[model samples]
Target: MDLSRPRCRLWRELVLVASLLACGIRQASSQIYITPDSLIGVERYSSSLAIENAPEDVQEYSWHRGANDTEENLIISYNATSHSRRDGPMYSGRESVSIRGTLRIWRSQLNDTGNYTVRVDTINDTQRATGWLEILELEIPQISVNTTSVVDGEDAVAATCYTNDSHVQWYVNHAPVSSNYRMTISPDNKTLIIRMFSRFDSPLQCGIEILPELIQKSDLVYVTVAYGPYSLQLRSSPTDFSGILSAEIGSQVEMECISYSRPESKYRWIHNGSLLSFSEKNITLPSLTWDQMGRYRCIAENSATQLTLYDEVHIQALWRRPVVSRSFTISGSLLVFLIIFTVLGFTHFLMVLIRALFRHYSTRANWSI
Candidate 1:
């Protein structure tokens, strides 16, 4: 019985030495660390802060609101041994800690932006890890405008963006809107005003940055501007003619009028300074006569802008002439050759007949003698 007691004491000493060595190795090799040193949090959204490389002998996990692990800044603590959670003095109702020492915040607010610290308590040692979270407010922006339609160089328009986001940007036709003499933006970048609104300032939009890579844009706004009926152009179907159109009588001619204008320009045709009753953009003159030849006018008018412009083209009529072809000349030459050959052959045949008859009559007379 005395020998058994001594063996038991030696076994206990061996077990204690092994446990101490294990603890020393773990403390030296395994360093406690936190994932995502920096986190981006959105208002009214949920996110998490995770810790890695946790000590295997952890007894408790404490999450603090600030960079320090002091009792006053403690948020929530989880007891790894009992598998239970305890709320600290600084804990808000939205915060919770998981068994793996990860901190989760739901329905985050703007005040949640600050440093975060997590304390890991183990049987052998205590360690702390810190991180930073930046909270941003984001919302869908709405555009408000005084008027959606204006006259070029005659009216001014204003557009305002409504959103909870502090950072704002304005765009026109997908390009950034810069402040100039004709356009101005408010100091807060919420309102944009334009004096003498034109077509160049159309398709306006506003946007805000919700996160580092996420951007939210508002509905697009378009403005209608009445412009000019300038650059009057009159074109013909036979585009080869430059200033004047020379047409054969009974031929057809087509004329088209165009101008750069908003709401489309009304066109009229005039011939010899008289209205031709053509109100469309194009006109056709079929079977043109001598009277139709002269100066033709195309009048373009924009009622909204009260601007008028006209283009003119001269037309001359000429009698159609016949065209001789090589085939016709070749046929005439062949006919003349045939007539001359027939005449020569007939004359040769008559001379031979006369000679034969004279010879036969002489032989008959000699035989009779």
Candidate 2:
């Protein structure tokens, strides 16, 4: 004898006995039975059992309350009867049964989330089947910010959170923030107000968590803050010049003046006594001419601080007018002619004197001989 084979046979026999017991209960009652008559907070409807088979003796079905079951809760109900089969030659005790019924669910609640069962009975047997009902509360509420932009020196800004449900919580950086005196939540329990000390560029996260479930978070929002201008200074390129400053006519000359500050400043170009429209890091004279030749200035204006800066530049004309005086020209010409005539006369006089002396010396020598 194999011990394993005997054990398997015993298990099968036990299963058959249980199935027969379940069927035999239906024979004990003539009616179909259901559980709890009412349901709450349930979104879907279902039953424990769909069909119940009973013997022919069953006529009417009545529902009975079981332990842990209540009235007004959803359940399954039905009615059924059995008929015997007869033949002309012989009559067998074999019977066939037919069942007719309707199923329905009652009032539901959020806490009614659980498993339910239906019991059916006949003259000889009773049977039961199990099912589940689920209730969900999904809702989102309104949220808003107290201030869109915060001041720099301020410790923190506040944002108000709201929701339709009673379960409301505040979150920042995906973590919950303390709802203390610094942060004031609404009395209705639908709003979660928070104040943060740090300045953040990314969006802040806030949300509400209901019991046994999580609701959607509030919309991500960006907070802006305003500050002041840090530093202000002038900058220029090739900042050296010399000589009889001269620049070509009808040519663009660049005069760059740059300023670095926390907040950028506006630039304006001033020529002589007039203000020009060119405002940039570098100011260029589109076309240079004699009329544009003068002192040029670059002024930077910071609207936030109401401050102005000045950078000076000299624009020299390419050509200078020739300076001439009538009196000086006439005097210079006369002086040159007078000097030439005096030198010629002085040379002729010296030659004549030398000749006369030579003739006198020759006559004296002949007389003494």
Candidate 3:
């Protein structure tokens, strides 16, 4: 054998050994970390902590209540071989560990706030990770109202927000509310008062900051505001009937009355100052006749506001000139037919008279001869 061949073989063996050592170093240097490094917990709620980059073939998992992984601080432990779990000295009834080395705390309370440590033991090695959780003294916010119904510009409405948090914010129609003559807020911003509640300030709400960037809102509170029978308007279906609608006789007409009111204004119709039989917002005239044409008025009233408003429309009857033109055409045709018949009858009479006279003369002549 040549000496150079042996040297090349020795160099190849050394390169293989270096590659194996690098892979072993990389595996040993891999770090284990915990998910949700920091979290906020609420009472009677659940929170979870999970491990990432943990060693595989984990045979045991141990969770501690504090950052230390001491035996006395162990909250819960799991045996991967038997797939069984045992409670430690610090184990609360709410703590559980998943097969993948995750810690879950149910019905978390204020005392649950602290650093948690998880130690995972695999067939080859062991690793540890820690995370912290904070518990907040918070609950769902609620709104209480003094009265649900109020008259516009005549009555006031008040609402109070109930929550454990003192920092509160008020909203109206989903928009932020501010202190003004019409509306006011309490010093703590918990109570909202409307001096003279209007329909615009409806659907009030309140909210509180539960966390640094999280806000919880209360349910909407609605106030029934009664106002206005104003802006009375009347329109016709054909749309041509307005202030002075000259409709042809026997044409159909539909009239609609509208107004701006909270409780929905009641409608009453009148024709030539006489109240119509129907009190509906809309009225239909199947056939427009002479008697139906006059000043039409719609009266809108609100029971809550005790206000009434009216809109009037003057409708004039048109003589349907097309029918008159048809009648004239028929009369002309009848006159022409009667004249032709009279001329034919006179000519027939003349012919009969001539024939009779001729027969009479012929007989006389014959006798005289």
Q: What lDDT does each candidate get?
A: 0.78, 0.48, 0.77
- In the range 217-309, model 2's lDDT, one tens digit per residue, is 778766654433334333322242641236778876666776643247677777787998776767656777788888777676656445666
Q: Kindly provide the TM-score of model 1 when superposed on the true structure, using C-alpha atoms.
A: 0.55
Write down the worst ten-residue block by lDDT for model 3. 14-23
- Tens-place lDDT per residue, model 1, 1-369, is 011111111111111110000111122337775555666556666667778788788999999988899999989999999999989898889888888998888877889889999999999899988877766564778998899878788889999999866678888877887789988999888999989988888888999866433456899999999888878888985552676887877899888898999979988888998998889988888888988989998899888888899988888865467886656345777888888889899999998999999999999999999
Off by more than 4 A, model 1: 1-40, 43-51, 54-137, 212-214, 240-242, 319-369
Better of 1 and 3 by TM-score: 3
User: Can you give the lDDT of residue 179 in candidate 2?
Assistant: 60
Which of 2 and 3 is the better model by TM-score? 3
- Give stretches of model 3 more than 4 Å off: 1-40, 44-117, 122-137, 319-369
- Candidate 1 achieves a global lDDT of 0.78
Q: TM-score each candidate.
A: 0.55, 0.35, 0.60
Highest-TM-score candidate: 3
